[model samples]
Target chain A: MDILHALIVLANFIIVPAIAYGSQLALGALGITLVVGVLRFSNFAHGETMAFGTMIVILMTWLFTAIGLSIYPLPTALLALPFGIIGCIAIVLLTDKFVYKFYRKAKSTPVVLVMASLGVTFIMNGLIRFIIGPGDQRFADGARFIIKARDFKTMTGFKEGLAIKVTQSITLVTAIIVVAALFWFLNKTRTGKSMRAYSDNEDLALLSGINPERVVMITWIIVAILATVAGTLYGLDKTFKPFTYFQLLLPMFAAAVVGGLGNPVGAIVGGFIIAFSEISFTYAYKKVFTYLLPADWAPTSLVQLLSTDYKFAVSFSILVLVLLFRPTGLFKGQST
Target chain B: MTGGYGTGADILHDCTVAVNKGEIAVIVGPNGAGKSTAMKAIFGMLTMRSGQVSIDGEDITNLSPQDRVAKGMAFVPQNQNIFTSLSVEENLEMGAFLREDDISETMHQVFDLFPILKERRKQAAGELSGGQRQQVAVGRALMTQPKVLMLDEPTAGVSPIVMDELFDRIIDVAKTGISILMVEQNARQALEIADKGYVLVQGENRFTDTGSNLLSDPEVRKSFLGG
Candidate 1:
């Protein structure tokens, strides 16, 4: 009975939520890393960009539902993903054209670009709040679970049985597919190599005949895709709220920095590490530990190190520690 | 390709030096001698402060660096010469980025010029040693198929053996009828291959003569060559 209860809590609280949250952080961090590595700026507006993307997806989902289109078991928002990505891409490209391009041409310092990105972030924040009315919207429906908790218990004939939500499964599978595609694009494509070249050395890249404007355009487009996918997957797993999405910036930046700011692989690893730590530390471990301890040794109190309210502090402390010991990040990211 | 923007500051001070087709023109000077500045001024990296730069009898003083490349002027900067993260072939491809036509043939020509690069085509340029990286840099510049290929201190910081090998490649390149304009610190060896030579000091032409004339001249021998 004790072991079954422990397994139930573990499945429900630790494993499932950790993966969903980690995938979200990975996607967000990937966007941040790409911009820092290639475009050479710490884009404070990235969180707002994610919010705007989800806002677009929500609007599209609403339109599709209004028109009487039914996606059935799968969420309707999935069908509208392409439109959301396109819209997000256009917004990013326009931002680059109007704001970033001038700084690029003037050869402004990267810190200045960071400030500009903050300004854009504020504008994007206000814009999203205005359009979405700053409220949580439950836009997902249909096929809610791959394995319902009751079905799992009846099939296994055990007190604890694995229950896989449809959204949870989708988040893992979608993140895997998207990350694989991104890696392939970066390592195998011609334009991708050109971006790496530009990131490594700007003057030489220019001298080599690489079109700077074209590379910049493609970077924004790729970032848009990653941001939209990350944003949508996150909204699907949890409730969709504008402010909640904006607050994700802290954890996303934490993941990016902990992994080494400009390293893609590091960001993914860091995301999972951060998610696991946040969950494991805050989780009430009495149920799981009860199985290992002798009858009288088991304490009455829950063995949680901290409450869930302090989750943000966990990410922040980890970021500061990584910065203090290894400012370049775990992957030895280029400081430039 | 001329316009009415008259030469203003005379940074290059009405210098008339020439290298015929298929000849090496060596420019030599001490540190801060305006040697590189002069090359950059012609390449449009710096707005010449003054003086006309004509390429094959066309005034190109006002052209952008990319436009200069289109007009068959390839400049190899002294440092930061190649895209370090890019593979050797991709670096060459980037060199030919402006060309609408296919560049496979030009790439083959570069491989033939520097056979070492062929062996490391897939290797990143940054991983190569200084001398080998210089070859990649030169190969990238050659992808443009220019009428004139200019190099700034091609043998700088290289071993004596590598310097000799690089000089041989420079001569081989000249044999293909592509004019060479190189600035060098190794004055004596550089003058050995020079058909024409210019000695610059304090941003002015101090000596203009045939390579042999400057090499044997007492004034040139005393100050530059440490004879």
Candidate 2:
């Protein structure tokens, strides 16, 4: 029944791509979760923040390429990532000081903070467009594939071939490292625990002598790091477009909410789930079913659940359902 | 001292409250009497228009609430006192957030004082029963090993049995030579264990005397102690 071929097809088309996308989503959702927990508001500007960071990476990558700086066999963007992160840090910190801090000092409601973030989203959106020209920018330049489809086919003697991209591998590895470091920072370090304490009870944290401004600054720095890494890896795998990153806000939020808003582990889990669902729903499973079924029973139709254009709708649907059923999310995160 | 939250009406006016080392001073008043507000002002949680907060004669009126913690003062709020998501041990660790030195010995002392907290040290503070949560909150305040410990209705929303147990813990804490300044809703029970009591009405000190003396006073008994 050609089960091996079916599996290879699925692996080539679904599993590998979903994993990378999930890792990227997990990183994005993490940034959102950290802001939600400590700042106690839904940051509407998250997508634009990612775009801003990625745009910085793209510009740096172009400059590096112009200067003939090459990390060859690895994208030069890898070298530019830290610079992008620094830029991101500066931008976000400036935003906090100039805008968010005013509302915070006034003891504004979280809803006001959220609306302010939405306003920030527009400004950043316009800012990125102004600088980057709102066009697709490709920075990924490395060994394109760890194992090419043709090579895998030749080696395995299978009709269906599997391919693994270098960028995908990098995305997976970086995600694992980032997530491990984040959890360690949250659980083991003094400042991290203080942030958690601040998130848990602001008044009590102040009573315990945890400085609020320092905590806010640290949270922003951490958000900048996460957003940059996530955005860069995503831009490396996909193409960097300011509008695309803005659109990505929806799925990233879905991932965050599905996993549990303000719950870090939940963000990771939610990322993978949304990624798989989006891919699976849009995938045409004709080839897989053809390989698995007998010749006489082969279907003529594509057998896709939905068109690729509806991929984001899958996240939207899940988010709506989760909100309706379990508002706190699967991991029992903050209720409202 | 005279102050209120956000420059609102002066809830506290010429309210003078003091506690001695190793002594327990209980502030008792009816609801809306500004008992918690007075404690909050003393801890620098509110702006005092014309008042001075001192620690061993050092004027701390200008110090922020966070700075006051550095001056060896710990406060336990009535609600949302503990970091609910944090484990009990983490809550204690956070309490000692300002302490740069080793806190293991202090942790051990807290564990010994509240043995149940030691057992549930790894558990999330929010998941604990109400009484246990109160213990965790107190343990969190004790982590700083401060000279003065302030509690705002520490026994709030607990059963009478849990209240008695909490009062015992408070007495045990006072025995460790830390001054305890507490706002309590249970006037009779609080006055019984307190070394000194201040009965406040409309944010003004209506009665100030030794605990036994206030408990024995017929006027205080009739009005506050519910004789």
Candidate 3:
């Protein structure tokens, strides 16, 4: 009974939250990796793209709720997701056409494109802040918990209980579907193969009659879809704040770099690594360890590796360490 | 034709080269002889300031290299010719990217011509041996089933035995009624099998004749054939 209680406590505190957070990071990292692989530049604007998409989803969710529409167990934001995706796609394509097209035509270097994207980052940052007013927004409206702690305790006849948020379950399921669909598209479809070919060798792809503009356009569309879904899921899980989304750029970048910048599989794995690392380190082990250990041997201190406030520091440290030791990342993806 | 790279001087001075239907035309010259430039000019990669490149008298001088592929021309460059990261089958599939028609038959033909490629179809093209990668490059070009196939230094870094083997495959391709235009560093062996040969010197045609005629010419033999 004691061991089971300890396990349940661990699950409630660390496992569930990390899995949910990891899925969000995985989607974000995939978007970054795809852009890096296909477009050959690290887009600094990605965080803002997510923010803008989430902002649109929040606005649409508000409008829907105001009109008395409800999905009950599912967030109404799910209904507004397509609109978010459309808005994100429009902005990304317009940015590509008005901005990226010039650099590509001039055959500018990747560094130049990187700098251009930094410029794009500022523009999008301001645009999102202006539209959303730099405040936290409430969009999540659904049955809150899939498995309530109170019900679990009553049913199990145990001192410890486990809870699972509906949003958490939704994030995991949605990420699996998106990732599966993405892999299928990349491996089995014509356009997907062409994109991979283009990513491998641009000149050869052109020689093979693969259109560059079409590939670029398609990449942005996919990136937008990924960013919007990830941002919305994250917003549903936590508080929706533009600045918080912007700050997520560091962890998302760390995840991409750690996974291998241009490798899709690496991104997903990297996401979970970052999330588990952050959660496990920061979580206080006072209760779970108390359950497992004899009362005399129990730790008086919180037994946390780092304070929860220092969570972002963990990502930064991992990023620096990986860069120093293995710049190509675990999957041997493109460096930088 | 006369042109060079971007904003550069003309590398080929009014150069003209052609291959007949179902014949192999080999271009051979010393280093920096602009042998590849002439081939690129014919393929519309360079801006031909004064001459026209035509296939069956349909002037395609203004056509981009991609449009030329659509017009039944496939070019295999000397280096980085194959998509290294893709599987051999994917490389061939990518070759037929512009085709709306089914490509299973064309892929089958490619596999038939290079039986080894069929075995390694699932393997990454980069993992193949040097000779096999060249075969993949040729096989990829052949996927288009073009009327004209241009190869630039097809046997560049491969062994002598592989060179001979590639030459045999080139002959097989030509026998299928597709014209072959190739730039070669192996002048003696290339001219030996050539139906027609162009010995270019300083980007101009120094000798243009039947393969045996050039091989037998005293000046051509002394100057080029290392006699």
- Candidate 2 per-residue lDDT, tens place, B1-227, comes to 99988858889999999999999999998888889999999988787989789998899989988888888898999999989999999999999999999999999999999999999999999999999999999999999889999999999899999999999999999999999999999999999999999999998999999999999999999988788
For all candidates, state DockQ relative to the true structure.
0.56, 0.88, 0.83
* Cα distance off (Å), candidate 2, residue A6: 2.0
lDDT of 2 by residue, A213-329 (tens): 999999999999999999999999999998899889889999999989999999999999999999999999999999889988898999999999999899999999999999888
- The structural similarity of chain B in model 3 to the true chain B, as TM-score, is 0.98
Q: Candidate 3: where is the Cα deviation over 4 Å?
A: A1-3
| Models sorted by lDDT, best on top | 2, 3, 1
Candidate 2 root-mean-square deviation in Å: 1.7
Per-residue alpha-carbon lDDT of candidate 1 for residues A112-169, written as tens digits (9 for 90 to 100): 9999999998889899889898888888877888988889889978776677888888
Candidate 3, A178-200: lDDT as tens digits: 99999999889999999999998
Poorest 10 consecutive residues by lDDT, candidate 3 chain A: A130-139
- Report residue B66 deviation for candidate 3 (angstroms): 1.3
Over 4 Å off, model 1: A1-12, A156-158, B1-11, B16-18
Best by lDDT: 2
Q: Is candidate 1 or candidate 2 better by DockQ?
A: 2
